[model samples]
Target chain A: GESVGLHLPTLSVQEGDNSIINCAYSNSASDYFIWYKQESGKGPQFIIDIRSNMDKRQGQRVTVLLNKTVKHLSLQIAATQPGDSAVYFCAEKGANLSNNDMRFGAGTRLTVKP
Target chain B: DAGITQSPRYKITETGRQVTLMCHQTWSHSYMFWYRQDLGHGLRLIYYSAAADITDKGEVSDGYVVSRSKTENFPLTLESATRSQTSVYFCASKWQMNTEAFFGQGTRLTVV
Candidate 1:
């Protein structure tokens, strides 16, 4: 039963402050990881991604850090805004083309208090 | 650009009923995927297609079926709807492996 899981089910942060969400996966062979932001009643939006080879990757005001040794993944947002309040998910890609094997974490509900 | 879109934004059905969720993408990406999002769970891949006429199942594919007749379309079918199938379905497309997936608005299906 290999799966990806989040460290926190919900996180509350002050507006303009930084926020960090964490995830841990059980699959050791997973080579790719991605962070997705899902607004209420909407589909998950791609935020950032990092491969197993690299420890960190940065995007516009966002960063994804991967720790292959511990099978941990994290997404860091530079400035927490009201619009950033959403459920963030972390997904890990499996080795094969099998879709079911690519697991997704339960997600962390990020709340930015404005 | 309407990168991806799912039809029947919401659906309601009874047990044993057959339902199909439609997903359309304008990007003509090489990879298309179907995922389900539940209350506590994030997005779980149900199926994916590398190209037209090629489809594969994901982790939670038991009660679902998918087909890609054309590159721009990938649809997921629930042969027999159940209470367990009540969730939001999302369709995503990616240009290549390990790339960011563009997601659709999602289809919320409720089985009574």
Candidate 2:
């Protein structure tokens, strides 16, 4: 079955260092891809997104890179902060209006050491 | 006060019990979705609605039911809860086809 997956279950980084999380998906028919940040006990928060037509997109301090050929996705955060410590997830949107609105990766726990 | 919200932030129920999780959004978005997050598993889509009265099942919809009587609400019902149903559920909505989804605080359900 086609699904989204993460490269690592957890990641540790220095407070001021950069952080990168990776994900791989199998569906090429997806409409777009999104990265979400989830704090403990809270819902996933939308961080950034990239459309299928584009290979990369950037937000305030975040960036999402998509590699269609390998069906891979990645989220890069510049200057990791203590508040950036959370579970990050990558998801690929499903077709237009079918059941699969988005398929998510298991998630990577990003721990920033202060 | 204009974002998505889920009721009973947390819940505990026994196996075989019927439970319904509520999700409400004030944006009047055209799309709403329900997803469950479990340990070691990616968030799984249970159901989604393109519009009021239009609903469809997702990858994991076997034991779940959903309805959207109004554009602002999409509730998920578990006919008979099982231990495996213990997980965090999130409700989200997007304004259009190509947009970021706003998520609720999420409901942590524990089936004992």
Candidate 3:
């Protein structure tokens, strides 16, 4: 079965440094991808998203890069902060699927040190 | 409220008991989804609804059922809860298939 996966299970970074999270999706037909941030004891919050038509998309301080040929997705966060520490997940939506059904990765725990 | 919300933020039940988690959204989105989060499994889709009376099973749908009687509500019911069924459930809604989805606060269920 096709599934979405993350490269690293945990990431440790110093404050003010840059952080990058990698994800790999097995579904080639997936057209939409999203990055979500989940804090302790809370639901996942939408961060950024990109469509297959675009290779890269940037948000306030985050950038999402999509590589279709390699089936890879990456999220880069600039100037890591202590508050940025949380679990991040990458999700993909297949084009053939109806509605907004999405497959989520196991998630990467980001720890920003003060 | 003006956003997605889940009822009974936390619940504890015995095995074989039936439990239902309620999810409601004010945006009237066309798509609604139910997912469970475990320690190492992240979020696994349980079921989804495209519109009123239109529902489909997702990756981990067994032992669970869902219905979308109206556009603003989608409830997930566990017919026979088991210890393995204990997890944090999240409900999400999006306007379209390619758009970002907003999630509810989450419901924590413990089955003993």
State which candidate has the highest lDDT: 3
Off by over 4 Å in 2: A94-100
lDDT rank order = 3, 2, 1
Tens-digit per-residue lDDT, A3-85, candidate 2: 88999999999999999999988887876888999999899999999988999989998989999999899999999999999
For model 3, the interface Cα RMSD in angstroms equals: 1.0
Which is the winner by DockQ between candidate 2 and candidate 3?
A: 3
TM-score, predicted candidate 3 vs. hidden true structure = 0.97
List, residue by residue over A1-114, the lDDT tens digit for candidate 3: 888999999999999999999999999999999999999988999999999999999999999999999999999999999999999999998865554678899999999999
Mark the 10 consecutive residues where model 2 chain A has the least summed lDDT: A94-103
Taking the tens digit of each residue's C-alpha lDDT, what string does model 1 give over B10-107? 99999999999999999899899898988777777788888999888776899999999999999899999999999999999989877888889999
> What is each candidate's fraction of native interface contacts (fnat)?
0.78, 0.76, 0.83
Give the per-residue lDDT of model 1 (tens digit) for A6-107: 999999999999999999998888888889898988888889888899999999989898988998999999988899999999988876435433578898
Q: Against the true two-chain complex, what DockQ does each candidate achieve?
A: 0.66, 0.69, 0.82
Candidate 1 lDDT at B25 equals: 95
Instruction: State each candidate's chain A TM-score.
Output: 0.94, 0.94, 0.97
Which runs of model 1 end up more than 4 angstroms from their true locations?
A96-101
lDDT of each: 0.88, 0.90, 0.94
